[model samples]
Structures are given as C-alpha cells and as structure tokens.
Target chain A: MKDILTIIFRLTVACLLAGLVMGTVFIATDKAKKHNVHVNEQKVMLSLLGYSAKNPAPASVAMHEVYRYLVGEGEALAMGYLLPLRDGSFSFVTIDLAGGFVAQNPVTLAAEKAGEAEARTAAIAVALGADKPLRYADQTIVVTDGGKRTAYLLPGKFPGFKTFIGAILAIDPDFSILGLEIMEHEEDPGLGAEIDQEYFKNQFKGKPLETVKKLEVVKTPLPEEYLKALEAEKSGLGAAEVASIQKQYQDKDIYALTGATISSRSVTNGVKAMVKKFAYRLAILDRVLAEQHIATPF
Target chain B: MATDKTNLQLVVNGILNENPIFRLVLSMCPAVGISTTVMNGFMLGIAVLFVQVCSSCTIALFKNVIHPRIRIPTYTLTIATWVTVIDMVLAAYLPEAYAKMGIFIKLIVAFAIITMRLEMFASKESVNASFWDGIGMGLGFMFGMMALGFVRELLGMGTLLGYDVLGFKPLLFFVLPLAGFFCVGLMMAFFNYIEIVYKRAKRA
Candidate 1:
C-alpha cells in the first residue's frame, strides 16, 4: 500500500509539472493568440470584399484606419452602429438585423434563440431544406463607397451534403453577387469541395437577386447563347459584343457542378436566403437612419 | 534496443531502416489523405515534423521518471500537451497556414507514427538519440509524402503546388484514395527491387 501510494504521488507530480508548463505557455502567448484570431477574422471579411489579395491584414488597413463612429440605432433591427469616413460619408457600417430591437453592443446575441419568432420562421425554412437557419449573431459589415453601399460581407452557414459549410457572401448594392468564398467545409475534396474554387464561385458574380431567388442547379449544359457569350468574352470580343453577352447572362441561373449538384444548390439557396434577410436589414437601416439623420456626426 | 548506437546511426535508422511511411508503414492515413496536393502534403509534413520533434524530446527527458504502468497515459498527456501548443501557435502566428492545415495539425495528435516513436524509441532512449530519431523519422515522412504528392498532383490534377505543370489531361483516378494505396505499394516494391539489385551486385 505504501509503495502504491508513493507511485501515485510521483505520477501526480509529473502530471502537475506538465500542467504547469502548459499553463505558463498559454499565459505567455495568450495576447498574441487573440490578436492573431482577430486579425484573421478581419482578413476574412476584407478578402470577401476584395481588400487584400491574401491572408494577414494589409498594413494599409492597420496604418490608415479610415472610419469613425457615427451615431445610429435601429428600431426594428436588433442593434446598429455607423462608422463614417473623415469626409462625412459612411465608409463602413455594421448592423444586426437578426434581433427585433436595438441594443448597445452589436455582439449581443439576444435574438439568436431558436424559439424566437424570427428564428422559428428560419427553422421552418431550414426544415424545408433551406440553408441552416440564419444564426448570424454578429453584425454584418457593410462596405460603402461615396455614401453608397457597394458591398456587404455577410457570414453565414449552410448544411452541405455532408456537413455544415461556413461561408462569406459578398453582394453588391442591388444584391448582385460580387463573390462567394467557402470558409470551412467538409465535403468530398475533389467533388463537393470544389465549391471553394474560383471557377465555381465566379459563376455567381454579376448574377442578380431575381435570378438567385429561383436559382436551381440544373444538370443541363448552359444555353448556347450563354456559352457563346462566355467564349466571346474569353476570346476578348469587341466592347459591343462583350457588353451584349454580359447583358444576356446577367440574370441567368448558375451552372451546376458536373458531379456535385447538391453542394451547388446548397450554396445557391443558402445565399438566396441570407440575402433576403440582408435586404430586409438594409431597408430597415435606411428608413431608420433617414428618419433620424444621426449619421451626420461632426 | 541497443542504447550505445551513435546519434548518426539512430537518425539513419529512422530515415532508412524504420522510415515511418516507407519501411515501417506507419502514418498511412495522412500519407494517403493529404497527398492529393503537394502543398497540402508539404504543409502537413511540416506540422508533423514540429510535433514529432517536440514530443520525442519531452518523452526522452522524462523516460526514467515516468512509471512503467502509467507510461502510456503519461506519453499521451505529453503528446497532447505539445499538440495543443502547436495548434494554438499556428492559429496565433500563422493564421493563413493554420486555416489551411489546422485540421491536419490537430489530427496529427492521434497519428500512429507519432505515438509509435514514443513507444518504440523515445521511452528508453537517450535524449540526443531520441531527438535525432525524431528528426530522421519526421524528414523521412515529409519526403515520402512530398514524393507521393508530387506524382499525384502532376497526373491527377495537372498541377504541381498549384502551378500548371504538363499540359496533359489529368488522370482523376490518381487523386483518389484508391490510387494512393496503389502508389504506396508500387513505391515499396520499387525500393525493395532496388535493394535486391544492389545486394546482388555487391555479392558478385
């Protein structure tokens, strides 16, 4: 019994040392670790809207921080904050559209509860196989140009054929897709995972809201006109020809991945649902701000 | 089993005699899973190298002090601690690389080759021997994965490290896990054949 107790005591000391060592390392690096996560988060958002070409937040962003808090609060929206540039135009503004009432911190996730009325509707949509119910607990950052909202980088999640796919949707003023990027996904690498490639994502660009509303991933080859337009554009067709082709394909549904139709449809329908909610938020934010004019902070 | 072996011999043992992927046939999962792309393989190999070395050193230092009955749990704790630190460090310092290979790094904590080293070599070995053994085994694993990745990426995707290589049509079969097994087998056989030829020549 004494020998057993001694062995246990020795093992306990070893485990204690291990814990202490790890604890020390964690304490030493905890600040930098958090900073890296935050920077990466910003980098993802910036890249979604075409700010940086790669990871690591660009020095321009850190050095020339452009926006300042301009006041605004939403009545119908959960929470809102406006950041206007030095020129008195809203450069970057973030708003929480998921919650029904305004709150101080946009990070407050008061309305994300599944039992909430809004969440119930989304849960029903999810049951109907629309992308996972929109639990966008964080503020959606809107990037504006010259007082006009140019793009929105909204984070969303959708249930892929295998697992939930996390993504950031970049949409233009009229809800035309700027781009879609897969942040995290567990689909078959070559098949379902190809959704991350630019070729698959590029098809969504310039596709307007009306088309995305009824978007279906059809297995049939693209229409001859659309194919010709794509070819003509690639062959550097003349300005008139390119413009005509661009116009023709502007509102068309996206082509499905040859083998992975379900993954393709998930992204399309997921974006459609998220955008519908985002449009609602934009409308609420616009009316609320226009009535208050609180964005004009000196 | 011999503790008196020189550090160089121990290192060479890992690289040649006990190569994790080729000879010992350890860590076949990562060897096949991430070898679809040269970049992925290379990144995962580096993560493995880092974890393997750290775990080996820690295990060697505590070999005598750790009780035999609890060695397995102790080794696991040590490996898990190092892996957690690495996972955190990658996320903190190399976010982009972390984003690409973070899942792979976490997966390495459970890798057969990593734990196998502690069981077979590090537990009773000298600190220097254990460290060199890790270096050799890790490098051997890295090289093997890279070679597999190169061939798979070249033929399966017509790309090398994401760059277009030959203008030939990609062989899709080569990118699948099924082809990975075939490649590994072919490589093992080829190496064995070379060794047989060398031995015959030496005897003659």
Candidate 2:
C-alpha cells in the first residue's frame, strides 16, 4: 500500500510540472497564432482578387451607401448601365466614386479598421458625426489602379466533405468571377480535398454571375466541347467561337472532381447559394429604383 | 549489455546491433504510414528524434523515483508533454511545416518505440548511457525512415526530396499503403542479408 502510494505521489507531481510548463508556452504564443491566422485569411482574400502583395493596402466597400448611390452625380455612372468595359480603360467604375461614398458612409470608416457589423456601426457613429443616424449597413474595401476598379473579394465558408471549408471568391465590376481561392478545409487530400487544386478551381475564373446563379456539378469526364473551348481560348483568333461555346455551356454544369463528387458538389452548391442571395438582394435594390422610374443607380 | 562500454559503442549499438525497425522490429506503423514521401519521412523522423531524446533523458533521471507499478503512465506523461510542446511551438513559429506535420507529431505519443526505450534501457542504465542510446536509436530510426522515404518517393512519385529525378513515373503502386509493407519487408530482408554476410566475414 505504501509503495503504491509513493508511486502515485511521484507521478502526480511530474504531471503537474509538465502541465504547468505546457500552459506557459500556450499562453506565450496565443497572440502570435491569432495574428498569423488573420493575416493568412487577408492574404488569401487578396490573392483571389489578383492582388498578391503581402499587405496589398486596405480597402473599404460600402454596400449600403451603394444602395442609395446618387445617379449622374459628379461623374458617377450606375449599375446595369452597360459599358462593355471600354477596352484597356474601364474608366467608368465604382472605385472613383468610392471617394464620394467614403466621405458619405461613416460605417465604412469603421469597417476599414475592423469587422463585425454591429461593432463597426456603433464605432462609426461615435467616431464620426451621425447626422444620417446609421441605418442598414454598407461596408466595402475597393482597390483601384489608374482609376479602374479592378476586382472585389468576399470571404465565406460552407460545408465541405468532412469539414467547413473557408474561401474567398472574387468578382469583377461586370459580376463575372475573377478568381476563387480556398483558405481552409479538412477533406481527404487524395480524393475530396482536390478543391484546393488549380485544375479544379480555374473553372470559376471569368464565369459570369448570371451563370453562377444556378450552378450544377456534372460527374463525368471533361466534355469534348469544353476541351475544344479551352484549346480555342489559347488562340486569339477563336475568341468569338470560344464565346459561343461558353454561351452553350454557361450555366449548364461544372465538371465534378474525380472521385470527390460530394466535395466538388459542396463547393458548387455553396457558391450558388451565396451568389443567389447576392442576386436577390441586388434585385430588391434595383426594384426600389425602378419604382421611382429611375433608369439606373449609376 | 557491456558495462565498460565506450561512448561510440553505445551509440552504434542502436544502428547496427539492435535497430528498432530491422533488428528489434519495433514501431513499424509510423515507419510505413509517414514514409509516403521522403519529405514526410524526414520531418516525422526529426519530430520523433526530439521526443525520443527528451523522454529518454528525463526518464533516465527519474528512474529511481519511478516505481515499476506506475512507470508506464509516468513515461507516457513525459512523452506526451514533449510532443505537445513541440506541436504548439511549431504551430506558432513554423506554421507551414506544423500544418503538414502537426497531426503526425501528435501521433508520436502512441509509438511503442519511445516507451520501450524508457523501460528497456533508461530504467536499467546510467543517465549518460541512456542519453547516448536515445540519440543512437533516434538516428537509426531517422536514417531508416529516410531510406524508406527515398525508395518510396522515387518509385511512387519519381522524385527525391520533391525533385523530379525520373522524367516519368516507374511504379505508382509504391505510393499506396500496401506498397509500404512491401518496401519495409524488402528493406528488412536487404538489411538482414547484409548483417548475415558481415557476421560471416568477421567470423572468417
């Protein structure tokens, strides 16, 4: 009994000492780990938007101020007022008017510093004079180069095969996909986790949002048409033919990852769900303008 | 079991006479599991070397106080603590490497080779002897894993340390789990054959 008691006492002491040491290390490194995670997230978001800089500067997007955007006010053109990108100079952009929106939107000021909707709104009212009194939220982070609004990114997460996959999807001013970058996932690397691979995600690039509204996953080999379209895409002369092929397949289906059908479908479905919600919200904003017989919110 | 052994002898014993993988045939799971790539094998070997050295030295010092009745749990606690510390520190400092090896590093706690060394050698020997033994055993395992990883990666991916040595893949079967057993078996036989020839040459 005494021997047993002595053994137990020594083991307990050793464990206590070990526990104390581990706790100290954990506490020491906690803040750095959190900072790394946030930076990695921002880096992934920026990379998707074609901005690969380590710090990429900061951007603030004002979705609500965009909601009540003044039309033809001080060189501002509106949404759905089509301009075919105008070759080399997509000069008419949301980014230039961004200066005006930034001056008007207080919530955007707070969003530039931190996230979380309620916290930003409250902080903005306290920091800036709230004559408009902070109603629905409008926040943005728009990066511009030579007066052209290049791209925009939205970070989101949805159910993956065996985990919640977080990713940042980028779209253009014309609501076409700029890129898709997976940030985190826990799917089987051999099969389901190929979602991170460029071969799988490259399909999203340049796909119009109208096509993404009703995405489908086709479980089969790459269709010959797509293969032909890819070959045509490389040669500059086949541009019109490639566009016609795209029009044929556009909204039809995306190829499923080989042997990771569920995982492939998960990403497609999640993207569709998120894009459809954004589309619905845009319709509401457009309807509000249409009711007053306004042509465009540009 | 030589009492008046030199430091060199103690160290060489693990690699040549009593190899954990080939001679003793201990801790084969990780030997096969993580030896998928040379990179995987080398990294896991590095982690195991750290844990093995840490636990062995600590166990050697506490041998007297550690009763036989509770030695298992005591040794386990020692190994687990070191593994956790490495896991956390690597995650905080070297996140990319940690993200790759963290899961495998945690699995090191369940290795029989670590606890086996504590019980078989450290408990019965002087602290210095056990420390050298730990280092020797760790080096032996690391080299063995790297060898396995080299062969596996070469045949599996036509690569070495991720360098594409072969322009085309020779055998994809070598990358699978089943291929691990075949590689370990063939390598074990090859080592044993070398040993038999070496002994015969010495006797002659």
Candidate 3:
C-alpha cells in the first residue's frame, strides 16, 4: 500500500538521521572517552595498593601488567604469561602440561597495545605462530617498590544476581587480601549493588589466602561493631583499634547483604577462585623463571 | 496572547496535576530502584530530562513526515539515539558522575514516560509548544524523583545525599523496595491533600 510505503520510508529516514548524529558524537568524544576510561582504571589500580590522588604513588613504586594466556587443548594444554622484562620489552613465557618451561618468545608491541586484549591476541598469534591454539585469558598487575615485589592486583569476574560482576582484588606477596574494588555489575540497585558499598568491600581486606579460600556467606545480619570496624576510615577509628577489630573477624564468614545473599556469595566465591588460580599460576611461573634463568620485571 | 498563558499552564499542570510519577504513576522502575539515594535520583532525573526534551523536540519537528502508524517506532529510535549520545557525552566529559549513573542512563530507553510524552503531547503539538511541554514534563519528573529520593534517603538511610543527618538509621525498612511503594503512596496522598487545600483557598 502507498501508506505502508510512506511509513517505511519515513522510518528509514529517521533511522539514517539518528545514526548520523550518533556517529558524529561518537567520533567527537571517542578520544576523550578512551582517555577517561584508561585514567579511571589506573586510579583504581593504584588506589587498591594504598595510593590515591591525594598521595600519589611514588616513582619508585612501579606497576607491571602481566597477561595470562591459555594455549592449546587437552594434554597439550599449556599456560603462557606475557611478562615484562627489565629491558622495557615483553616476552611470552610458556609452561607445558607438566609445569616445565616450553618456550619463550619476544612479543613486540607498544605498552598500551599490549595491555589491550585484541592487540595482545594479534601479537600472540604473531609471536607464537599459526599452529598453536591460544586464547587470551586474564591480566594481572604486579606492584614493585624499588625493585622489590610488593603486591599483585587481579581483576576477576563471577556470575552475579543478573550478570557477571567485575572486581579487582589486591593481594600482598603472601597472597593476603589488601583490598577489593567492584569494577562493574548489573545487580539490582539498593540490593545486590550494595556489594560496591564501602562496608561490604572492606570486609575482604586483611583476609589471608587461607581465610579467603574458606570464606562463606552467612545470612545473619552484619554486627554494628563489625560494620564500624570494616569502615574504619570513615568511622574515625584508630589504626590499632581497626587492626584489633579486623583480627577479631579475620576468619569470620562474610555477612550477606540484607537482601542480596546471592551477590554476596558470588563475590566470595569469585575472590576464592581468583586467589587460588593466581597462586597456582604464579608458583609455576616463578619456578620456571628460576630454572630457566630468565629475569622478569615483577 | 492566549498561547502564552497556556504554555505556562502546561508546565504547572505537569508539576502539580499530571506529574509523571505522582499523578500518572509512570516509570515506577527507576522510581523504586534508584530512589534509595538523592544523588542517584538526581542523576537519573537529569539524564531523563535530557532524553525527554531531545526526543520530544525531534518528534514534534518531524511529525508531519512521520506516518501515524509508525510514529511509535520513530519515537523509539529517536530516544535510543539521544540516549546513546548522552551516554557517550557523560562518559567522556563527566566520567565521575557517569561512574554512578552510567547504568541508569542506558536504562532510560525503557522508561515509559518518554514514549508516553511523545505519543500523547509532542506528536500533535507545535514545535514551540512541544518544547515547552518537554520542559514541563521533564521538570515534573525530576521534581517527583527528587521528592521520592528525599523522603526515602532521609527515613531509609538516615542520610541526605550521603551525609548522615539523623546520625543513626531510624527505620532500616525504608531503604528496602517494599518501602518505596509505601513512600510513593503516602506522598501521593499528601500531594492530593495539598492540591485540594489550594483549590479551596483559591475559590474562597
């Protein structure tokens, strides 16, 4: 019908106009948006290690980004780490199924490009050659102060109430939790989203790997004293008092958010899995590095 | 001459009589969800206002060409485009606020209030009238959200915009979704009461 044709034509025009406007705006803001995302991520990474805008990280404190790759399948399964060397270049170190050094190849890419997954995938394909099946896994950051390794930052995700919740976990050399920062989530606001609140996030701090692995979600209400201690910075509690309170509840199960038990459990499980996997992977990487006599930035 | 007075009335009507939330009872999702905090409510309100105004203006400008049968789809596309533009702009320029309000911005496309305004008001009105209507409805929605947020935050969290006013939580139940319903209901009753009183006084 003529009427139908007119409706279709008008809708098409509207679509084209909308697309054109969005395209222009996207192009205009693309650079600034990317820059903001990068800066915000950097701020989060630094803050997890006790550095903030007020007290900037010292030059001596360097954060090195190390990427993980799961290569091959079945018996041929191997783990590869794209590590930073002291010489300002990167190397892909592979450990085979038996945890023995397989091969090491130089990965040449700009530092920023290497940090991004797509670019890293291409570089990996180039460095490892065509025959190997490999996929980019995850990335971790190592914080070193004056060449002494201090902490490790792991970005992890797990199934939340609605979708996966992304979080960054900071751990010391001994694999004790330094802090947790919820990066992104689609959980219900005023409920599961409370996981990002200070009191909830601070509960993960000071938890050792043993405690973290055994952490459970308790449905009981969070105690007032525990809440105050967890939010010590805001509560104006002294360091000694905070430490004491932390020690008291260091091994206690995580108190579930009043109405978001699933979300609380999800995060607890995520932290446990992330810590366990990182510890296992790092142990293998460290041993291989020592045996191969290869120096790493971390 | 008469047009000037009607334009002002449109705005006033939006605020008091046909308030998007209180009177018409539209977009209860964000109302109950994000109204837990004043800042959250205010941020969402601003984003909604931008999208509403932009979409209404676009609809009014092209209403002649837009076939009545397909006007709904056109309105949706217009809203979607504007939401994306606003999302990118906020993410780029106001990343700090965007950090808190990013999800809410994307969720604006689903809001019934925007579509309702386009269909009922903007589609038939002049560009100038549609613009004023957009301003009125947008402001009414914002005021409604802020009022809900104010009551919810005050009683729910014992805080106003994250500041502890009561020093301690008075009623923890107010922070829950269940309380959102009760608060909206009470507020609606209070608004109706005020309107009746004002009408009586004016008649006297």
lDDT of 3 by residue, A177-221 (tens): 999999889898779999999999999999988898888999888
Q: How large is the C-alpha RMSD of every model relative to the true structure?
A: 8.6, 8.8, 3.0
User: lDDT of all predictions, in order shown?
Assistant: 0.71, 0.70, 0.88
| Model 1 docking category | medium
Instruction: Tell me the interface RMSD of every candidate, in Å.
Output: 1.2, 1.2, 0.7
lDDT of 2 by residue, B82-177 (tens): 998888888788878877888789889989888999889888878888888888888778888888999999998899998889978999999988
Q: Tens digits of per-residue lDDT for model 2 on A1-298? A: 8887887788789889899989998998776777777778666766676457664544542121122222233444432211112121111112122322222222223323344445544554554454423343232233354445555555668899898988777776666777787878989968988888765776676678878877789887977666566545344437787668766766567799889999999998877765665555455544543453333213
Residues B157-195, candidate 3: write the lDDT tens digits. Answer: 899988989998888888888889898999999999998
Say which prediction, candidate 2 or candidate 3, comes out ahead on TM-score: 3
Please give the range of 10 consecutive residues that has the lowest summed lDDT in model 1 chain A: A62-71
Ranking by TM-score: 3, 1, 2
lDDT of 1 by residue, B1-204 (tens): 647878788778777777788799988988988788888878888888888899999999888888888888777788888888888777777777777888888888778898889999899887888898888888888888988898899989899988887877469899989999988899888878988999999999
The C-alpha TM-scores of every prediction are 0.74, 0.74, 0.89
- Error (Å) of candidate 3 at residue A9 is 4.2
